[model samples]
Target: MEPTSSAPGQLQSVTRALSVLGCFRNGEDLGVSEIARRLDLPVSTTHRLLAALVEAGFLDKVDVSSRYRLGTALAEYGQIAYRQHRIHLAEPHLEELAAITGAKASVATRHGNDAVLLGTSSWREADGHELQGLRLPLHASALGKVLLAWAQAGEGELARLPYDSGTARSISGPAELGAELARTRERGYAFNDEELVSGFRTIGVPIGDEPGQVRFALGLRGPVELMIDERVPFFVDLAKVTARKIADVLR
Candidate 1:
């Protein structure tokens, strides 16, 4: 969903149209009515927005299903953005880390109140192929905590965290999260002990040169049984080494 209020001169139609595009997910098609229900707009208004997007190559209609999917234009733009981020340079290192850890490894950055996966390598069942571009709640993910902790997010951003989006193990509010972040900073890493998904654990390490200058983070995820306390130091050390490799490539 999109925010209702826009800047003084912003066009409502443009905002609505962008929101319609955001409704789509990886490998999924959605009909106009479903999109309308998600955005809580009238079907006619949603239809008009969808039509405009289709005309602009941001969406395509499947003739058989009468559903819309993200179009080639988005894929083109996504690829352009991906290249600009230089994430490809770190892909091999991520793959190496995954192989060594027998888990999933990824690079992520903060986007609003979420952590957006930029590149990922998974050698086990814990992480799926669809992880790239996936958005995880800032309060519920190890990558997110690393970003928030090392970047020193402003008060405004901290206040807007979607605490309810995470599981029971997630930090309850800003105060609690602030304490967790302090500990994460002191320990040189962050952890997600079933905060996002039960039976899963993840460790995140900063990818930048120092605390305040961190622009990205590296994450390692596996089942809790595989990520138990006894093996955490090994995983964290490997993750930090992988993070340094990624930071070198990013620089």
Candidate 2:
């Protein structure tokens, strides 16, 4: 169907083009027919919109599968938005976490089923690692567990998210996850025993409201030996202290 005209002299093509772009929000690669069906438009209109998006570098045509996916433009815009929104809200605490622990500090948010790194404070002289826009397992990593524990703190939040045991130390399932999260609540910390990476342990604390809709985390990552042996308990205390201090600012 021809897109309904909104105003005199306004090309309806622009409106249809936007609809086609919106189809990628489901995080799936879309074929021409799928895009057309989703937008309730004719194939010809969908093809035209897709061609425009590809030409303008807003979408890309995958030759192997003949599918269309979001292009570099969206990634660039997303990075800009992450820095402007989440990172700006998180930076001050990140700096303090890094300073107090003398370890790398990072904050992350749930992006789809994965954890997206929002920001980090790393003093190069302090042997810290880079942490901008990295993705990690939802069931692993101090960063991921902090968010999970935050979710688990709520009455029914755990049911909303699915779990997988792809990692050697992932929670195995949601029931186990709920149990672990309960422990985190009581202990005021979470642990990643090489759950995300082999032989690398991290201690993390979730930062957010009671329901644990954790949009940010205060994480200290290091070698598993140091992370678990003499350092885990010490880091746990530091994380709790760090979390309370950051919460003060967040309020």
Candidate 3:
């Protein structure tokens, strides 16, 4: 078997411990033998690594089965990393958009077949509820459509379609979703006219490090009265500008 670490001295122990922790997935519980088999390590070494990780609060040992799973420490660290990397980088731009338009502004990144909200900003105090982990349907929300449009270019097809309908207007077929994505590409933004929720509208533009490669989407959403047809052009322009600003910061 290959050595766990290339660094000198005790760093090897740290590498083995990390490897042990990495073996556990979101809903999986593993014993030392399974981890050792996966890592091509001996049972005794794997048991030692697991013991250290459990003691250090990186893994938790189940009382009944004696299996190991990821601990709360990893989740706490993950939230910190997510805040520093995604939310901190995108919040300023969202705030600027929300301030200019007097609506809710958000940043989302593609997660599987959904757009996962990373951060949001709103001028209204009552609208300040957290939406950090919200997942919007790819075939329904403006933010999701923008990401799907860009991803389609590389994959040569849309993500498997006919997603659960968020509203009567939500796209319900592959062909319908394909056409919407085409329109999104041509118009340089995606628009949702009460597609996700009744009486609500949103416009979203992709954020990218370069042309034609989207990393995330920036969006503005509000009541239909405030996001009427006449106001869509202005919101689209604002969303695109804010997306560009966020891309610059991320780069």
Candidate 4:
């Protein structure tokens, strides 16, 4: 007689396959043995799963190393998930914010050590920056700073500050970034003055009220001349209100 179990063999296979896929880290590749060791599974089982994933277009094998990494299929699914979880909920609010501010508006969510732009809104005649589907450095972009500031404090993974330079004003050290994050937390917003892009400025606010636990950020961007110190307060207020609206919809 066949053995009884809480999960059927097919379901177990599906779970194991997903676990194998999960082992591929961002910017890192893995061979079958490494994956099997991580999953605590037999080498033969891991190889079978990897082959199946490669066949299904869920993973790609490197020509030189024979290692496996995430494939285009994951990116396709990621975009779909981003649309469903973020873009659909944020579009109306971002549109209204852009209309009200006469500036570019965008929403972003943290992904690994980067901020992924999910949606953007711009005035009809405005030549705003197109950033949807773009991944930006966490220490340079206003939206990235906002998300990073609100990440769980003392989380070692979040503390890895790879301060890639976007402009001369970009944060270059962990100390400076930590101070900046502190200020962002205190002010309930983050500002980037030509840090990511020369001649442009941006301000961002978190979507939720809880500190150190934000999942989304809303931001406004415009030329530095247009987003002057005198006008920053107004834009910040608008961003906060719009963030609240988006949060309401998300909730």
Model 2 C-alpha lDDT per residue in residues 84-157, reported as the tens digit of each score: 66466667767776776666777677776677766677554444353223667666666776787777545365
lDDT of 3 by residue, 18-116 (tens): 777767743589987889999999999999888888787888999899898888888799789776775687787888788888789988888777788
**81: Cα error in model 2, Å:** 2.2
C-alpha positional error of residue 220 in candidate 3 after TM-score superposition, expressed in Å: 0.5
Tens digits of per-residue lDDT for model 1, 110-207: 88888988888845675644243488888899999999999887667777887997678988998888889889999999999989887788999999
Global lDDT scores for all candidate models: 0.87, 0.72, 0.79, 0.83
Off by over 4 Å in 1: 1-10, 128-133, 154-156
My TM-score estimates for the predictions, one after another, are 0.91, 0.62, 0.66, 0.67
* Candidate numbers sorted by TM-score from highest down: 1, 4, 3, 2
- Comparing 1 with 3 on TM-score, the higher-scoring candidate is 1
Off by over 4 Å in 4: 1-79, 122-133, 155-159
- Candidate 1 weakest lDDT stretch, 10 residues: 124-133
List where candidate 3 sits over 4 angstroms from the true fold.
1-75, 83-86, 122-133, 153-159, 209-212
* Index of the highest-lDDT prediction: 1
- By TM-score, the best candidate is 1
Global Cα lDDT for candidate 1: 0.87
Which clashing pairs does model 1 show?
A: none
